[model samples]
Target: MTAVVHPAALPADLRAATIRTRVTVPLRFPDGYSTSAEVMTFHGLADGREHLLLALGGWEQVLLDGAAAPLVRVHSECMTGDVFGSERCDCGPQLREAVEDITATGGFLLYLRQEGRGIGLYSKLDAYALQDQGLDTYDANLALGHGEDERDYAAAAQMLRAVGAARVRLLSNNPDKAAQLTALGIDIEEQVATGVHLSEANSRYLAAKRDRTGHTLQLSRAGVVRPAKAAAGKAPGHSGMLARVDALVPGLRARAEEAEQLRRLPAVTVQELQDAGVFRILAPAGVGGYGLGAQSYGEAVRVLARGCASTAWTAGHLTEHAWMLARWPREVQEEVFANGHMPLAAATSAPVGSARKVPGGYAISGHWSFASGVMHSQWALLAVQLDGVRLQALVPNADLQLLDAWHTDGLRGTGSNDLRADGLFVPGHRMMDWAQLTGPDNPGSLLHRDPLIHAPMTTLLNLVAPAVAVGSAEYALDLFRHQLLMHKERNGSFVRQADSVLAQARYARAAGAVSTAQLHWQAALSLLPSEGQADAGLPEAQRAPFRLSLALAAEAAQEAVRLAAGGSGGSMHRLSHPLQRIQRDVGVLLNHPTLGIDPILEQAGRGLLGLELTMRSF
Candidate 1:
């Protein structure tokens, strides 16, 4: 055997080549580019580990034919940085850039499972704990009884050889990776440096890597790394909007009492919200709105509620009404959104009005209550019964008579007063049949392909109120925590409320309940149809469960707010205290006919038991 040695064969000691599998698949990016890649997997290596070899765009064939030096990167796994977008390191950005580059040029990328520089996950967490105590990365590793860099390149070399990549242009910032590959007898034609993904959290770690391990990274005078410009036409996520709302919370909190005294949202707060684009989230993008999805809309409401629940409630209604109006005919939409300005609308979905069918329209006369944000709206979505059929009529705000009927203990600032319309002639174009809106063949569905409009009307309607409850509960918890830390006992002992075990447990329980409620709400939202997909529509059983989940979310929020109020003691009962208002607001929200827990639970239980539901609509 010594007379002739085969270059493709592994050494005798590392001969267990038990499994080799390859599949050609297409890798698509969110940016809409796609390319073919050969995903090769090898198992039972010398280290009893497996590795993946991705050969992009016929690079495997090129390597096999010995015709080119492919662009190669041997990447180690970092779960926190890669999967969770943690800014503690540059691993995520490096991996993303590597994929884009390798996919662009025919190349090979070896993804190794060596996590935390081969220190293992839990040990790496321990190392992180040590680093938090002022130890550098190298010292943290040494303190944890490991080398500064414990990762080995033998498996990477073996995978490269198995894939027939004898020569490569290495894409890496670590000089040690290149030296290790070179020492493994693999030919390195060139080395390409990756970008420096910097943040305040990872600046120290990055500097230590560059100083100690000879990493090729350039840092600015402020120790920050600048990111590359984003690609054109890419829409930002809800994080930016959430950040904007978060910045307004303190200001909004300052005006809560003023808003209650004014019997509506403070004019300044309303203008600030309008300037921040809070009311236009669900408006059509063609009309200069973001047309955001349910998750983002719910999150914005939750964030706004942290400052003032009543303001968030009004904002939520206006945004939701815009979404509902998007289902109207194009002519109606144009009329409502004339002059490129978004029209804030107030909606009452219950069919409480009588409509007489007239030529080219219906004459509606009725009283609708709980019209949140009606004072600031230019239009109203009124539900009426026309010719014994339910219809949603969009009437101009000028046609409706506002009644001062919004007296309530909680959510007084919402200005949810009654509005009456006497023989108002709403054009046929502005009136949509309630059944048509719920059906798959509505005018909105035919005209606009936004996924939000395609969702079940009942589901969307039920989701609106719970957003305020969730936000109010979260705000209540924050107030409770602040009171605990800041307020001392009046018994002259200077005892902190947070020092009590009961207070800690109460905070933990309420936090868990609110968090779980949000999860349920998110899960229900996920079941809705997305854009461009055929409307399969959820089954009745699923809809029942969804309603039950929403009701539970409301109940959970109420419980959390109650707990927070109780934990805050008698000071929370004052009229000026925001917690008292939030408690009252959440209480009123829970009493809503749609979000009442008992009826929803009964419906869900009936569905689960395969029993006939008592309610006809559900």
Candidate 2:
């Protein structure tokens, strides 16, 4: 264990520590976000362990201007989460965010090597073991004969003073950091709360910190957003929802790798999506939803994909499932939406299950694969073959088994697991025939006056894949451009790639592809048959054209990402790079049956030639 000597014990007029070494280093994060830091080591008296201070952004200019206090963060190290991407704690994300936030302004990040909060790594792991057997983090430490928190900020205060940061805007949620520094003669101009990095694996740990240690963590599980005040001439629903999600983009991008490692959407991400009202976009306004149509829903999914494709994929499907549930019998809809909120449901039609006719309902049994968002869903929409007919069955999650079978090379965070059911009884009211569910005169249409409820299900479902594809490809292009502009080669300038004519041509081609994809997407949206009009029950000829446009959009999106990936250099091949992940995600998305270029194109041809439609999904 590292020894700690409290700075308060020393004389009030103590001298500042001398700087031992100072060096500048170019830094590259796993997400391909690049920056530089002036790393400094100090000669200190208290706590002899080596600690680092990274001066980021324009520190000298900030000091010279004296307009704002320098942002500072005294971060304690956690090897498990920080280095290995462990989900047991929020250390990794906090550290990553602190660096980026401080770098945005002129600031310092004091990376203290106080592993395990000064209890040492081994003891921390021991505490984790105790936690597994029913102990909070603090209690676990206390059980092992250690203070609830062994961390001391004496060294941190010294480092800040040595770096001439007598006053700073401390970026931390822990009040202890500010209190300790203030007691040790540092002026904490402000104690800014860090973004809450909550995950399913660390929810309890964070709660423990908040309740036990008085950390300023706003842990809102439901993620309810307050109503915005009405403004004259401002577009309502869509803009409000978009603004909420736009604010969450940075946090989502930061947690993308962590979500992938967990093989599911984190709690914080799910909450953020819920807060943004993405899941409620399809439900009728009577049920407290936005009552928006496919166009709005698709736009939101595209926006979400720019941050994390897996999240967008899962969220898009979950949103669609809510719309699907509206087609069920009125009683079932009432039950599902009785809680005054949109229900989270996951659906799968592939590897169809079998359902047997019973007295009150059907008994569902079989394994369904690729149920995206199932981990967080309260209900599962299982497509089953009953005798010779296909039907949709709504089964509560309690009745179905969720298998951790979503292991894949792409879109790993979706948690698209396999769901199993053995004689699970689903009431007749909750079951609807496949034809009626997608038909124009479905139950939802009769109940809700909104034209969206009467829209074609096939076309709406087909739009989801391309929205994710296009958004991910666009993000890839942005990352690649940033890489060319920021990352410098050993013997070349950072702008060298930007100046290359060939590189500019490639970038232009990629941009054109993205624009083309977006055009196709808009064309598809435009083709939506006007519900409550003469075209309400549109034929296959009209719908097939929509699918064709989406297929082309998906193809163009993939091509754009391919171009960006080719030019992103070898450094982006690392698993942590966002560009590489976007490439893999778009590749997998193009393989979806809804966006299959060959089948969709062939179906369009069949429709045009006045032939029968062969593609069931289309």
Best by TM-score: 2
- Candidate 2 clash pair list: none
What is the C-alpha local distance difference test score of candidate 1? 0.75
Q: Mind giving the per-residue lDDT tens digits that candidate 1 earns over 522-616? A: 76667655433444366776777777777787788898998888887765676756788888989988888878777888888998888877885
- Residue pairs that clash (backbone atoms under 3 angstroms), model 1: none
Give the lowest summed-lDDT range of ten residues in model 1: 223-232
Residue 291 accuracy (lDDT) in model 1: 66
Q: Candidate 2 — worst ten consecutive residues by lDDT sum?
A: 224-233
Q: For each candidate, C-alpha RMSD in Å?
A: 19.1, 13.1
TM-score of 1: 0.59
> In model 1, what lDDT does residue 12 have?
46
**In lDDT terms, how accurate is model 2?**
0.80
lDDT for 88 in candidate 2 is 82
Which lDDT tens digits does candidate 2 get at residues 265-349? 8897887677667778777766656676666778888888988999989989998888888877689889998866679999998
